[model samples]
Target chain A: MTPASSMNAALERQPPRLMLADPILTMTGIEKSFGDVRALRGVDVTVYPGEVLGIVGESGSGKSTLLRMMNLEDMPDRGEYHLALPGQEDLNLFTLDRFSRRMLRARHIGIVYQNPHLGLRMNNTSSGNVAERLLMAGERSFAVLRARAKESLDASEFPISRMDARPSELSGGMQQRVQLAKAIALEPALLLLDEPTTGLDVSVQALVLDTLKRLQRERRITMVIVSHDLGVIRTMADRVMVMRNGDVVEQGLADQIFQDPQHEYTQQLVHAKL
Target chain B: MKLDQLTKPWEAFSYGFLDQSAKREMRRRILKAIAIPGYQVPYASREVPIARGWGTGGLQVTLTLLKPSSVVKVIDQGADDSVNASSIRKFLRRVSSARETLDTMEADVIQSRHRIPEEKLREDQILVLQVPNPEPLRPVQPDMSEARIMHGDADYGQLWLTLYEQLVRSGRIMQGSSYPSMVNGRHVMTPSPIPRWDVPKMHMAANLTILSAGREKRIHAVPPYTRVEPLVFDDVPYRIEDHADKTCYRSGVTGFFMNELPQDDGSSSFEVSDSQYGVKHIRRQEGEPVTLGETYYREGRLER
Candidate 1:
């Protein structure tokens, strides 16, 4: 059988359904340090499938570091990263070899960094950027990759006809959407977004967020977004994790974290936003 | 004091003063290489105060390409710790202070001579070859201008004819050392000074093959999946040489072209008698080991 046909069959066999029976990602007693400075200290969090978990914190509060740890891009000095795979329960991402973890990230996990310009190659066309992950996953045929890339762009509300245009020609929001298209093209089980809408204007941010919400619903993708914007967290997050000095001060449903914040730090954050 | 004699030490120290400028130039060349993806560029190469056949080219490339996270490997012949290999390794350690490895499988950047490692290389890994001469046409025509003009017009007829003539004379092409092949069917490139035994292994190889001539100041690449054909004649056929057996005493690896070692007793003990015993013995003493096993023999002839 052809490779494309086999990939299609595999996609069909595992339909886009949320599996919430077990926690998709679990971080236990996580701690990180750079030289003498401690970034994260004794932090624990759990992420379930098909849920948008927002991690809100101030600058230098270790939100980005935590996200990096989750993606296995940076290993914590002391932590356990137990990630759930299909038919497997809580595999430690940190313990795996670099190649194996790379394979897992390539096939099952996708990350969108904060800088849209950095996320996608500026020299490559939009379609090229979108199709990169698919190509890396052993999809060699240009026709099939282009088709899937086009479909993803259209789904993400991007201008599909302009797929040949480079990222430098596109606006910040459009670049973010192109990155989203790239991440979603692989049909990743987990999506880790780090301030994906920070550079875009409000209108563009709303459009991008709406696209993400629609994608999460259709693909049943689990999302963990790290951002400082409380408004964004309120709009998309099912649960909120409020961090302070590398500690999760409050974590519960978004409403509870916003309306009935128990910790002083969370209260101060809400007051500052107000 | 005689002016020339007095100025000699200053001339020697001038290389140290010129190092920063040379590195900047190399960085620009490397950036151009990355920007164009597979294109090679000429850079101002310095005599690294090491042996010519050593990894001066690889060292220069690594110095230009290194980041804090890079893990480097250096191999000579094939094993990691031959005398020349250790010499380059020590130089890099002293110069770049970068991490070094003997394991081919783990290196992010590898500097190799004579043989590509038996292990598969990852896409992220970069392989740099030390090249004596970058031009494939230098052997046929001694003049640089004529060779350059021939390369410009993609004229490889002379090379093909030479191979055909060798085949007619010997029933097989018997040339070795710095074998010539076409890169992407566009540029005729020498696969450095590796033995002819390792020539066929570079065909459509997985890693990006970068060749640098430190003395010549030229760089080139054979991109992944690009055709690398050794010029051959149809009647006699292009045949590759291999050891009768794959055995390396030091590395204990199989399926590798090996160097044969002489026993300490000096009794002419046969380590599987085959063609080119002297060359193999010299290579073995130089720390290249034969791959363990019986030599792969076909009808009484051992294919190199």
Candidate 2:
């Protein structure tokens, strides 16, 4: 059976009512508009827990917009969005107010922007930036904050000795790692990544990609990564969604999308990458 | 308009020149600052009659702690009667009805700019130091938010590098005042532009030191019994000013810090920087009934 068929068969095996149950996120008819332009047009996405879902598209394709929506940084003009947290009922993210959304973002969502400068505070020490997230999570103990900061840095392979140095003093790859450390410090259930290694050197990108893949596997984190780079998706994501002009053109298992493309836009993407 | 609704009561001015709410906020921040020994606590620094940069931070702390029974001493560069010091002292007294004293030993709370008193402060005393720049990392990292993060991380690599460069460029470290010193083995604080000699006095001292920068909007504390070590390389030891042996010309006091009066002939006359200390010494010489407290330094050497 084809990978797409297999995915459908797996879904069919589960109870019909429980199909959307315990997913990391569920979005239906998500529509966003900027001025007269449609940023996202009727986008629907469902992410399973512990799965890495890659959304691939060029600029203005609404990939970043979709990721931002997941992060709760931006609200769609119209849509139903539900975030299923572990040991809790599905959170109606769209219905919550701003402060509640902020609390949810701090507690359960971690977003890594394309630009390190946008994602991380350049002057804060690596560990400090991480501790900030912990502070937002209502951690008051300095000793505990320091310990957790150090632990997360160590886990991300960030040099413990350099924890005190600001982001401006670090290399680009190291800065990204610091951002990762900060994002993961609170142990968020959902990780939203926006072109995480877009500006790094090829070798550095490889290393960062490897670290990210390893981290996702080890932590069993549910991730929605948006990138224009096909290689990034092929390496890190288990499933792939192709977007063009604010709409998903096609989506399937990573291997299926690479080996056999059902849609013309996806075929062009695969062809362009090769 | 009803008189009772118009105002609570016809008062000359608020106590301590700050309303109750302002004092309460300051007290809350002060407690947090003391709890996290060297950490810079951000507070809603209220506006007073004084300008933002001129000892407003120290004034706020003093006002928050002031009572009718409190004895306050205000000093500028060790002189108790300088324009800045006397003005602050007058303001403190006028607003709070607190007694003002020139003698360091008699004062319950001492508000100072750029210098610690020559005399050792008792445990009951609280030293409010007016800081122009509170960030020790400003020279290395210019951004305040970034500097704060650096403080959180305990990442001070660039600070050491700057010192190393200073030693290489000039045979000695060129840092003059506001010597960067580590507090409680965790935070590096700018000890309020006080000379190197005064910096050491904060190290495991009996009195609580509150360094507040009104312009920068940050307050940090060096609590009693906390370690405050001036940053230095292993090979190059931290040195106090060479004025150790320079005697005060007017009072004949040889061990204390001195202010130089430049003469036309290129020779500079040195006077005791702590004006009150010198006054006490001169009074005692004239056979007046005056008692001097134990000083931090004795005979040009800092006593441990």
Best by TM-score: 2
Best by DockQ: 2
Give the range where candidate 1 chain B is weakest over 10 consecutive residues by summed lDDT: B268-277
User: Per-residue error at B188 for model 2, in Å?
Assistant: 16
After superposing candidate 1 on the true structure, give the runs of residues whose Cα lies further than 4 Å from its correct spot.
Answer: A1-20, A87-90, B1-212, B215-304
TM-score of chain B in each prediction = 0.74, 0.95
The TM-score values for the models, in the order shown, are 0.51, 0.56
Instruction: Write one digit per residue (lDDT tens) for candidate 1, span A9-68.
Output: 111111122323566788877888898888888788778778888999999989999998
Candidate 1 share of real interface contacts: 0.00
- What's the DockQ for every one of the candidates? 0.01, 0.03
**How well does chain A score by TM in each candidate?**
0.90, 0.91
lDDT of 1 by residue, B231-285 (tens): 6533334555565344545433334455567788873222322222223445666
